[model samples]
Target: MTGENVNDTTGDMLRVEDLSVEFRTANGVTRVVDSIDFAVPRGGALGIVGESGSGKSMTSLAIMGLLPKGGTATGSIRFDGKDLLSERESAMRRIRGDRIAMIFQDPLSSLNPYYTVGVQIAEAYRSHRSGVSARAAKKVAVEAMDRVHIHDAARRADHYPHQFSGGMRQRIMIAMALSMEPDLIIADEPTTALDVTVQAQILALLAEIRRDTGAGLILITHDLAVVSEVADRIVVMRGGHLVEKGSVEDVFSDPQHEYTRRLLDAVPRIDDEIGELRTTAIPVVAEEEKR
Candidate 1:
């Protein structure tokens, strides 16, 4: 597939071209993410789907400049016409939680146990905006919690993260991300630790937030069904290489690559006729822009 795009800037929020990530080890240099290309358009959502160790998370980390100590990324990662790969660490720090926020897989590990939830959220807000008093920051934190539909947000703000349930903790993480009013959000397995019902709720919340803020979204996950309704486009990866990329409808209905067809077959369906699983590739018509 081609990796070209239009010159217009209507929805070109994040563009990743020929991106590759490598790690140096005692054995030798190992490449975790091969040369890959994709883009998340303005106000649009893109999902990266594959099994474990497929480099989906690594791709997200590369874009955020949060790769492991030994990992290094090559190629271009442009956000709003600025190449993040070329920016200094200090400059990247300014952009990380301010212009581009992230929602991690687990909130418990990400949140601090020593501080109150409200204080943590307030600190994240005040760090980006200077000359903000504690009272105002706390007010912002409470409002953010309320926006996420947290019950008694003012009271819960004073409580520790351990006091809340897993679902509520995730909402708190979302509140922290919303406090920054970022232009793009990279959510890595946001609903992994939650139950099925909670997973649906979190996904719905993410969709609503995207609708309200018009922020570009990059959802990194291993489940194909998890991102089916949330993402506008889908990119299938295998062994660090992009096996198929297309609109969500196109990829789900008619996968072009053999690897992609295999993934679809692995998903359990309720309406399936009790028979053997098919592994044949379906016809896929390539669109003009294969972002």
Candidate 2:
């Protein structure tokens, strides 16, 4: 389970080097992701920011071994010193939800409406952990839900996805990811389509979770505002190329690339401080209310 460090003595949770993704069609080959390099330090947060079709999601999908048909990835994707690109599908399956978890953009589509939220969460947990009783898995599911601040989680577990608000359903997605206690979490536009207040709540919850669990985070989003709140490092992508990479502070203070500067300008509140959006607090529930 141990992995060698990437270009440094300090070990990294995940390291991507010269990764390129391409799709072959009747017309020709299209390279959506050029050779790009980045790393997530253990327990650190890395943000991949870009506009739509900038290959942010494709890079994550490549890391997860979930690339869509007709797409192929080349170069190294190292997770904890292991070369994920070389790993077999079976090995990747074992590592996917168990060691590395992903939070998708749309929780509704990721969840099943026919199943109770608890059932879905428990099933996911059981799939990764063999020989666990359903009752044990269900308990884990409830705990996970509670960990994500889903109020009345034990009762709410029985509710279907539709019964929950958009923010709450996103929390459910996070709960499912937390249930596994993975080493790294890749969240792709997790706050998309959420209201401003709800987005802040979700971001706070994610920051709290990372602090509590010491899990490395990969947050992919187009919003510079969102990443400024949570990420320690920033990677800017455009047309599959890595235009900029640096500490969040440096990137925000003095962007080197024209594209990066444009992205910052596109922020709705460009006048406001960049990293100040993290002040939102996660709501706390009393223990007595759990019953």
Candidate 3:
């Protein structure tokens, strides 16, 4: 879909208002994502969190114009200035992978196993801009991989997705997302499959990319800790509806909703109660003093 001009909306980089999605069941109409209102400013990061079926993924899909067939989406997804629902698929395709892009959770599914990593990245680049030669596109791909700290990017460029480790494959996904240099990047649980350490690395890399490029980010996930580090704002959803929305500190420290409060409490903290638990163990190790 043709992107609406940003000049039309005040302070709205991406505004999703009253977006309702429904699925037709033999039983009746089942609404998956209720009418929800949220916005992301230029260079802003909005984190969405909830349990499964909370409609977080569906919301992102609606925004990306990638919702599945047979699902009816209603409401306004204003990117910059245009209403996305009004645009046709071909129009949206032009914007997708160019002005706007997504990084999915599963790198293996997102990438082509048969093609070289470089080939896929280059293809993505070439699709948007005409006259960008294969060599030039590959150069962009390599540069993007290098930017994400992929070592020997030129050498790894020809490797298939299966050849890379899980973390490396994730880095490749980020590189592809970065290649287009889109105005917005919808990353749906980008670190879910990675180990804790690698998760941090990917999050750090995304934060760095966001800082350096000034691109607005929509991070969709269920982990509060992940969003706590990278998201400026957080929106909590429950049972297909929004329960809470606020800055990271506001939602985590002083949550208004009971669901949000419980989510915050569930997160394991390094200090406070955890520290007390450790202290209890520490006194046992000094039994010699008591003797």
TM values, all candidates: 0.89, 0.89, 0.89
After superposing candidate 3 on the true structure, give the runs of residues whose Cα lies further than 4 Å from its correct spot. Answer: 1-10, 269-291
Provide the overall lDDT of each model, using Cα atoms, as 2-decimal numbers: 0.84, 0.87, 0.83
Question: Where's the lowest-lDDT run of ten residues in candidate 3?
Answer: 282-291
Expressed as tens digits, the lDDT of each residue in 96-130 for candidate 1 is 99999999889999899999999999999999999
Query: Model 3, 61-145: lDDT tens per residue?
Result: 9988888887788999999798999999898998898878899889999998899999999999998889999999999999999
C-alpha RMSD for every candidate: 7.4, 10.7, 11.1
| Superposition error at 210 for model 3 (Å) | 0.2
- Residue range with the least summed lDDT across 10 consecutive positions in model 2: 282-291
Following a full C-alpha superposition, what root-mean-square deviation does model 3 have from the true structure?
11.1
Instruction: Supply the TM-score for candidate 2.
Output: 0.89
Give the poorly placed runs of model 2, Cα more than 4 Å off: 1-9, 269-291
lDDT of 1 at 178: 92
